[model samples]
Target: MKTKVNEISIKYQGNFKISQAPKISSSVNAAELLYNTWNKDQIGLQETFKVVLLNNANKVKGIFEVSTGGITGTLVDLRILFAVILKSLSCSVILAHYVK
Candidate 1:
Protein backbone atom coordinates (compact mmCIF):
# COMPACT_ATOMS: atom_id res chain seq x y z
CA MET A 1 0.00 0.00 0.00
CA LYS A 2 1.14 3.53 -0.83
CA THR A 3 -0.37 5.88 1.69
CA LYS A 4 1.10 9.34 2.11
CA VAL A 5 0.83 12.01 4.75
CA ASN A 6 -0.54 15.40 3.77
CA GLU A 7 1.28 18.57 4.68
CA ILE A 8 0.27 22.19 5.16
CA SER A 9 2.18 25.51 5.11
CA ILE A 10 0.50 27.26 8.00
CA LYS A 11 2.83 29.59 9.90
CA TYR A 12 3.78 28.69 13.40
CA GLN A 13 3.22 31.31 16.11
CA GLY A 14 6.11 32.25 18.32
CA ASN A 15 7.58 35.30 20.00
CA PHE A 16 10.91 36.75 18.97
CA LYS A 17 13.88 36.18 21.23
CA ILE A 18 16.68 38.67 21.71
CA SER A 19 19.93 38.00 23.48
CA GLN A 20 23.38 39.49 23.66
CA ALA A 21 26.39 37.35 22.84
CA PRO A 22 29.02 40.05 22.52
CA LYS A 23 31.58 37.39 23.03
CA ILE A 24 31.63 33.61 22.91
CA SER A 25 34.11 31.24 24.43
CA SER A 26 35.41 30.84 20.94
CA SER A 27 37.05 33.70 19.06
CA VAL A 28 34.97 35.95 16.79
CA ASN A 29 35.91 34.06 13.66
CA ALA A 30 33.34 33.65 10.90
CA ALA A 31 33.65 29.90 10.56
CA GLU A 32 33.19 29.23 14.25
CA LEU A 33 30.23 31.58 14.68
CA LEU A 34 28.48 30.12 11.63
CA TYR A 35 28.63 26.53 12.85
CA ASN A 36 27.37 27.45 16.31
CA THR A 37 24.31 29.27 14.98
CA TRP A 38 23.37 26.38 12.67
CA ASN A 39 23.69 23.82 15.44
CA LYS A 40 21.17 25.85 17.42
CA ASP A 41 18.66 27.61 15.13
CA GLN A 42 17.61 25.35 12.29
CA ILE A 43 15.36 22.29 11.94
CA GLY A 44 14.52 19.89 9.11
CA LEU A 45 15.36 21.22 5.63
CA GLN A 46 15.59 24.78 6.84
CA GLU A 47 17.74 26.06 3.98
CA THR A 48 20.74 25.22 1.79
CA PHE A 49 22.83 28.38 2.21
CA LYS A 50 23.47 29.95 5.59
CA VAL A 51 24.88 33.31 6.69
CA VAL A 52 25.99 34.66 10.06
CA LEU A 53 27.87 37.59 11.52
CA LEU A 54 30.10 37.97 14.54
CA ASN A 55 31.68 40.77 16.51
CA ASN A 56 35.41 41.24 17.13
CA ALA A 57 34.94 38.75 19.92
CA ASN A 58 33.54 36.23 17.45
CA LYS A 59 30.03 36.38 18.83
CA VAL A 60 27.02 36.35 16.51
CA LYS A 61 26.63 39.99 15.56
CA GLY A 62 23.60 39.66 13.30
CA ILE A 63 21.56 37.39 11.04
CA PHE A 64 22.07 36.99 7.32
CA GLU A 65 19.74 34.19 6.26
CA VAL A 66 20.04 30.45 5.93
CA SER A 67 18.29 28.46 3.27
CA THR A 68 18.54 25.29 1.21
CA GLY A 69 18.06 26.65 -2.28
CA GLY A 70 18.99 30.31 -2.48
CA ILE A 71 21.43 29.88 -5.30
CA THR A 72 20.12 30.52 -8.76
CA GLY A 73 23.06 29.71 -11.05
CA THR A 74 26.68 28.65 -11.14
CA LEU A 75 27.79 32.21 -11.88
CA VAL A 76 26.76 33.53 -8.52
CA ASP A 77 29.20 35.84 -6.77
CA LEU A 78 31.10 33.89 -4.17
CA ARG A 79 31.95 37.21 -2.50
CA ILE A 80 28.28 37.98 -1.87
CA LEU A 81 27.98 34.64 -0.15
CA PHE A 82 30.65 35.77 2.26
CA ALA A 83 29.60 39.40 2.38
CA VAL A 84 28.18 39.13 5.88
CA ILE A 85 31.22 37.25 7.02
CA LEU A 86 33.46 39.89 5.50
CA LYS A 87 31.46 42.73 6.99
CA SER A 88 31.71 41.40 10.51
CA LEU A 89 34.99 41.47 12.36
CA SER A 90 34.53 37.71 12.59
CA CYS A 91 31.74 35.56 11.18
CA SER A 92 30.80 32.05 10.15
CA VAL A 93 29.15 30.28 7.26
CA ILE A 94 27.26 27.02 7.46
CA LEU A 95 25.60 24.73 4.94
CA ALA A 96 22.33 22.84 5.42
CA HIS A 97 20.36 20.27 3.46
CA TYR A 98 17.33 21.29 1.42
CA VAL A 99 14.22 19.20 0.70
CA LYS A 100 12.91 20.29 -2.67
Candidate 2:
Protein backbone atom coordinates (compact mmCIF):
# COMPACT_ATOMS: atom_id res chain seq x y z
CA MET A 1 0.00 0.00 0.00
CA LYS A 2 1.08 3.52 -0.72
CA THR A 3 0.48 6.52 1.46
CA LYS A 4 0.17 10.07 0.23
CA VAL A 5 0.48 13.31 2.11
CA ASN A 6 -2.59 15.47 2.07
CA GLU A 7 -2.24 19.14 1.47
CA ILE A 8 -4.92 21.45 2.75
CA SER A 9 -4.83 24.40 0.46
CA ILE A 10 -5.39 27.49 2.55
CA LYS A 11 -7.54 30.08 0.84
CA TYR A 12 -6.57 33.69 1.08
CA GLN A 13 -8.83 36.64 0.43
CA GLY A 14 -8.42 40.36 0.77
CA ASN A 15 -11.41 40.20 3.06
CA PHE A 16 -9.68 37.64 5.24
CA LYS A 17 -8.03 40.66 6.79
CA ILE A 18 -9.93 43.67 7.92
CA SER A 19 -8.38 47.03 7.24
CA GLN A 20 -10.56 48.73 9.84
CA ALA A 21 -9.28 46.40 12.57
CA PRO A 22 -6.46 48.40 14.06
CA LYS A 23 -5.52 45.58 16.41
CA ILE A 24 -3.64 43.64 13.76
CA SER A 25 -0.50 45.15 12.30
CA SER A 26 -0.76 43.15 9.06
CA SER A 27 -3.33 41.30 7.01
CA VAL A 28 -1.69 37.92 7.44
CA ASN A 29 -1.76 38.37 11.19
CA ALA A 30 -5.36 39.45 11.09
CA ALA A 31 -6.46 36.47 9.03
CA GLU A 32 -4.59 34.15 11.34
CA LEU A 33 -6.35 35.70 14.32
CA LEU A 34 -9.77 35.27 12.79
CA TYR A 35 -8.98 31.79 11.63
CA ASN A 36 -8.15 30.88 15.19
CA THR A 37 -11.17 32.60 16.73
CA TRP A 38 -13.67 30.98 14.40
CA ASN A 39 -11.94 27.67 14.52
CA LYS A 40 -12.38 27.45 18.30
CA ASP A 41 -15.94 28.67 18.53
CA GLN A 42 -17.50 25.81 20.47
CA ILE A 43 -20.81 27.52 21.11
CA GLY A 44 -24.01 25.82 19.99
CA LEU A 45 -22.12 22.95 18.43
CA GLN A 46 -20.92 19.42 18.99
CA GLU A 47 -17.59 18.39 20.57
CA THR A 48 -15.58 18.78 17.39
CA PHE A 49 -12.46 20.82 18.06
CA LYS A 50 -9.45 22.09 16.14
CA VAL A 51 -6.04 23.47 16.99
CA VAL A 52 -4.08 25.93 14.86
CA LEU A 53 -0.38 26.24 15.39
CA LEU A 54 1.32 29.40 14.21
CA ASN A 55 4.95 30.04 13.56
CA ASN A 56 6.82 33.02 14.96
CA ALA A 57 5.66 35.01 11.92
CA ASN A 58 2.13 34.01 12.79
CA LYS A 59 1.78 31.85 9.70
CA VAL A 60 -0.18 28.65 10.17
CA LYS A 61 2.34 25.89 10.71
CA GLY A 62 -0.37 23.27 11.13
CA ILE A 63 -4.04 22.76 11.87
CA PHE A 64 -5.06 19.71 13.88
CA GLU A 65 -8.46 18.31 14.74
CA VAL A 66 -8.49 16.50 18.06
CA SER A 67 -12.04 15.32 18.46
CA THR A 68 -15.55 15.72 17.11
CA GLY A 69 -18.14 15.26 19.84
CA GLY A 70 -21.66 16.28 20.76
CA ILE A 71 -23.62 18.17 23.43
CA THR A 72 -23.78 15.15 25.70
CA GLY A 73 -20.20 14.11 25.21
CA THR A 74 -17.30 14.54 27.63
CA LEU A 75 -14.87 17.38 27.44
CA VAL A 76 -11.83 17.16 25.20
CA ASP A 77 -8.32 16.57 26.52
CA LEU A 78 -5.76 19.34 26.85
CA ARG A 79 -2.89 16.92 26.30
CA ILE A 80 -3.80 16.69 22.65
CA LEU A 81 -3.24 20.41 22.39
CA PHE A 82 0.13 20.19 24.11
CA ALA A 83 1.17 17.17 22.06
CA VAL A 84 0.71 18.98 18.77
CA ILE A 85 2.70 21.97 19.99
CA LEU A 86 5.39 19.82 21.56
CA LYS A 87 6.12 17.82 18.40
CA SER A 88 6.07 20.92 16.24
CA LEU A 89 8.09 24.07 16.69
CA SER A 90 5.20 26.47 16.94
CA CYS A 91 5.61 29.87 18.49
CA SER A 92 2.00 29.91 19.56
CA VAL A 93 -1.29 28.03 19.32
CA ILE A 94 -4.97 28.92 18.98
CA LEU A 95 -7.76 26.59 19.96
CA ALA A 96 -10.57 26.50 17.41
CA HIS A 97 -13.30 25.05 19.70
CA TYR A 98 -14.64 21.95 21.34
CA VAL A 99 -17.90 20.34 20.15
CA LYS A 100 -19.65 20.27 23.48
lDDT top scorer: 2
Q: Looking at model 2, which ten-residue stretch has the lowest summed lDDT?
A: 16-25
Instruction: For candidate 1, write residues 1-100 as lDDT tens digits.
Output: 9999975332223344325554445334544655555634433334445544545544555655433443331222466655545554454433333333
Model 2 spans with C-alpha error above 4 angstroms: 1-45, 72-74, 98-100
Candidate 1 regions exceeding 4 Å error are: 1-19, 26-42, 70-77, 89-100
TM-score leader: 2
Cα error, candidate 2, residue 85 (Å)? 0.9
lDDT of each: 0.46, 0.59
Q: Write the per-residue lDDT of candidate 2 for residues 11-78, one digit (tens) a residue.
A: 33335443233343465765566455554456556556676666665665556666667776645687
**What TM-score would every model get versus the actual structure?**
0.37, 0.50
| lDDT at 59, model 2 | 61
Query: lDDT of candidate 1?
Result: 0.46
